[model samples]
Target: MTRTTTVRIAMNGVTGRMGYRQHLLRSILALRDQGGLDLGDGTVLWPEPVLLGRREHALREIAERHGLEHVSTDLDAVLADPDVDIYFDAQVTAAREEAVRKAIAAGKHVYTEKPTATGLDGALALARLAREKGVRHGVVQDKLFLPGLLKLKRLIDGGFFGRILSVRGEFGYWVFEGDWQQAQRPSWNYRAEDGGGIVVDMFPHWEYVLHELFGRVTSVQALTATHVPRRWDEHGKPYTATADDAAYGIFELDGGAVAQINSSWAVRVHRDELVEFQVDGTQGSAVAGLRECRVQHRSATPKPVWNPDLPATERFRDQWQRVPDNGEFDNGFKAQWELFLRHVYAGAPYRWDLLAGARGVQLAELGLKSAAEGRRLAVPEIAL
Candidate 1:
């Protein structure tokens, strides 16, 4: 018989889309359905979740729907519980630092969504406190675990991309201005005062994606714009969109490789996926999306003669070979949650801590500065 141990986790911000769908439904509940996670020695570590939120009614609805017993609107009360072993935060950027600080003070292992704090200093401070308190700490770096990126990482490890040259990424799709149609994203995402802006939102994603897959980002050049000037809020009221809806960035990597990525909420999509990255190297090049990857080798490269008057003969899309998934891939968020749980329970090595999160925040801060100054900016390393 397997020994069972319960780990009480206080989850905040379940009212939000990401927190509800990804963290609660897809990750925690799914883990619960799997009879908890194996500790590799015949011990099954179970999760006991305490849902925390501002709206009691919403929290109660979710709790009742999931058949959960614990639900609370009071954060202080939840943190005061000695039985609660971990605190998981998926709150908005503005409210995250204080809650996380309280959790750390309560001696709970802390895990949170990205941009761990609004700025680099706040992120670094959280890392410092976590270290001082000797608590397990982690920040969600979910993209690293995506199937497309996993395949890309495999290729890099197998020396497929010999002397990688550059990477080009295209991300984003049109988000309706809420006047005509309801905006897909939250209204807070468009208000600069509420920690909105594409630079702050996406540079964190690009930071880890670039640093982990290719090389550390040394410098960044960016231009940001607020294409959709006005939008409707959740209440169907019109408000000026103060945050940038689009950002164009060029990042310089440590090994002289250059990366350019365009992120926008105001553009239309005409690609295989909403987000796609094409990585070029001396040996070959590969394009990867959320779940699929395709590669074009040097030997398979086709030459095209420049003839403006003539129609192109080559079928460009048919040239690249699809990369197969050799193994089953789990949900990225669930995978990271498992890793964080292991890091807390069994002392597994987890590198995507608050410090790594701080680096991401650093990039976002610099990216915004670069766009504002209309000049390139250096990304200094963060130390906790």
Candidate 2:
């Protein structure tokens, strides 16, 4: 057996929600708590995360909470530390490029949250820089790690879904208006200047899923809207909604498979959680949520249509069978964090690379363009 590699990691943006949850607490501390991670397929190791931030107090609090010994407010200082091998970025979208560039210059591997930058060019540039520096680079497309989505991928791969015809993805929830006594959500996520919006923020997940399950998106037609023009902050302060709240997009893929994605911050869902992807194929259809998978096949099709005017005899409802949970499930974000660490330490091939992320940004840009021009837009060819 090969001895495990010991990795020293510098976690940037350790104070934010995803940063705190995935990078610091779950990926670092949780893995340590579980002794060591077994990254299936023979990779077994652990990562040592040194939290980094710009605020001293926040960093101290986070470090102390995690019982971590190393924490720094200065990014350059953290990057310069010889002990740090990987720099993890969970910062807001706008700050990602600069921080990642610095990490590449410092000769450290990088794993960051998606939509690498505000545009595809920036994402490609970072990919180029990382290659030039000979460092591993990856972007989080955590949706792929969701057990439900993974099941969907398995089905697609296994030919359980013969010739997948279409996919419908529903993503979002009612974001608290930040009014009254509610604390304001991240300010950056609501302002276009800050790289905030449903389209740019969530399309990366869709991009990877579409690529993984079906094929690359060739073109797109979309419409985006800001349902609530103005919102109130935690302290009853008024703020303008500079970014879109909802987007509906159609993605045309390579093999005649079409995907329709709907992302919103204003819709309510009753049947399941906000995020779901349903695939309909010639052989069968599957609906997958964040935690569960259900299947309905041609063999189980309803025998007849029931009418209220006659005795009801519909049997299709019973044919839908629930697939059991495979095992312990990690939150999507945390799962990707573990994968990133394993990839960095064991040289595991990470599928969600910069090229995939750039494709996502390209889709978002094209989606907006399509919406503005009222025409389908070809996904711009990106230089990997």
Candidate 3:
């Protein structure tokens, strides 16, 4: 018989799309189905999740789907349980702080999805409280574990981007107006009052990605606009969209790399991927999307002359080589869950803590400020 360690996890806000889908079903439950993760020391660690949410109907359905008997609408009752070792919050951005604080005060280890809170101060406070309580805590930074970005990291580590210069990212596609067909995203995503906008949603992601792969962000300049004034909701009712639908931003990294990323819900896709980053270095350049990455080296460089008089005929697309699948990748969210669980059980060094999450929130806040001010703003280091 194989030895296994079972950790009880209380998952709050598991009824939302990201909550139900990523953290609950695809990650923890899937891990359970796999007989949990092997610790490589003859002990397998398993996660036992207690799903908690406000909607009893949805919670019951989700629990039944996962063969779980523990489902709760009474948060205080659930939090009082001594058996629940960890508390995970996949709640909406606005509600994250309060639930996490309660979990921390209840003596449970904390883990949560990012923009851990809507603002930087709240995020920082969570980190401080967790440290003071001497409890393990983590925040979702799933992009760092992505296979595409992982491959890019491997290249950077291997000296592929010698003296990296700059990074350019293009992300987004047109979301439907919800008149003829349903909008692909939730209606709340277009409302500023509800914590919805391109800047808040994406800058956090950019912060971690750039900081982890390249270096810390030093400064930011951004422009934001509410391109779509009205959008229909789930009830087929039109509502005024007050948030910025699009954001164009530039960031300066500590390693001297300049990163410019554009995010929008009102644009059409003409690029290679819905989200792609092209990193240019002295020796070469590479483009990485959600699942695919391609590269070009200095040795294969071709000189082209710009002439308006002549018909442009250069095979620009054929010069890059595709990166192959070196190894199978676990789902990004699933991978992070395994790591967080390992950290909880074995005291493994997991670096994506609440502090890292706060940095992401900081970037988003600064980006918005930069857009409003129409000037560059330095992202100063945050101290406890």
Candidate 4:
């Protein structure tokens, strides 16, 4: 048995929806139970998450339920502690930047959720601050670690997509109208005042996905809408929906491949998965969702004549073959957390840094800009 090295983290947002469920309960605590991650040199890494929040009772309850002994309502006091190895932020999108800046000042390694800041400049500032302070910083890019995407990556690497042509993405489901049924997402997701909108919320994910899977995003043109203007709140109170519920986007990639991504909370699912991408190339095409990936090779490709004169009889759905799951797929959040822990505990390097996070914010910002200005905007590279 190797020695377990403890990495104490001051978790500032453990009381929030994502923080408690994904980071604390699933990632950190689960890692602790699995004997932590092995550090290649007969050593193990143990994550110690100290819950910090505005609500003492909620924080205490989470700590107790999760078998953590440390809980605090005072964030500043907790961050000031020298024992805390890392400062993590999964707080509300509006409240993240200040706490992260404070963590950088305190010389702690930092990890945070996406859209590192509300604006692109603020996100870039955080990147610069981390570099100046010489601290390791990372943001959650959990989707890249998904099993379906991983399989898609394999096909791309294998030249299954010989000369990629275009990419089409469909994401979202019908979030219930609170008048009749409970909404699937939090009410804040539809409010602009609370830093919520479809473009800002979903475009960040699309940016990284397209950039990683295909190539760098050279340009973007988007159209957004606020469908279903009225909605009931958590307390059954009616409120005006201020933010956009849908975003239709076209992105020009590095290789001149055009990617069309449509994200909407108002649309009903008619595709194979809740989120799916169908990539077409000179050789073949593949569609990948969160868990499953399907492919159509050129050899197995189907051809049919289009005619409006007769009734359709082609079963287009049966043409593609299923992609195999090579191995067990762990929770994407947990997988990213493990990699982050390894990077912190050992001297291992991780490519997804604050700079990458800033790019995501840039896409969201530019997507909204394009929507408003009714023009295509170029995505200039941000040098670190």
Best by lDDT: 1
**Pairs that collide, model 2:** none
RMSD of model 4, in Å?
1.2
Candidate 3 global Cα RMSD: 1.3
What's the TM for model 2?
A: 0.92
TM-score of each: 0.99, 0.92, 0.97, 0.97
For residues 343-376, could you state the per-residue lDDT of candidate 4 as single tens digits?
8777678978899999999999999999999999
**Sort by lDDT, best first: what order?**
1, 4, 3, 2
Q: How many backbone clashes does candidate 4 have?
A: 0
- Give one digit per residue, the lDDT tens place, for model 2 in 1-384: 545556788888889988887767766777778876786666567678788878889988877876788878889988888979989898888898899889999999888887888887788888888888889888888778788988877777788878889999898877777775463367557788889988888777787788877998888989999987787755678899899889999999988999998998877776576688889999999999887889988787566765779876554546788877767777777777777776776677787777777888888878878888999988756775
lDDT of 3 by residue, 149-217 (tens): 888998899999899999999999999988788999888888888888888888889999999999999
Model 1 spans > 4 angstroms off: none
Give the lDDT of residue 233 in candidate 2: 59
What C-alpha lDDT do the candidate models reach, one value each?
A: 0.93, 0.81, 0.89, 0.90
What TM-score does candidate 4 reach? Answer: 0.97
RMSD to true structure for each model, in Å: 0.8, 2.6, 1.3, 1.2
Per-residue error (Å), model 3, residue 153: 0.6
List, residue by residue over 1-384, the lDDT tens digit for candidate 1.
789999999999988999999999999999999999998988889998999999999999999999999999999999999999999999888999999999998899999998888988898999999999999999999999999999999899988988999999999999998877888999999999998888888999999999999999999999999998989999999999999999999999999999999999999999999899999999999999999999998888888789899998878989999999999999999999999999999999999999999999999998898988999998877787
In candidate 4, the residue pairs with backbone N, CA or C atoms under 3 Å apart (3 or more residues apart, or in different chains) clash, namely none
The alpha-carbon deviation from the true structure for residue 272 of candidate 4, after best TM-score superposition, in angstroms, is: 2.1
Candidate 3: misplaced stretches above 4 Å? none
Better of 2 and 3 by lDDT: 3
Count of backbone clashes, every candidate in sequence: 0, 0, 0, 0
Judged by whole-model lDDT over C-alpha atoms, candidate 3 comes out at: 0.89
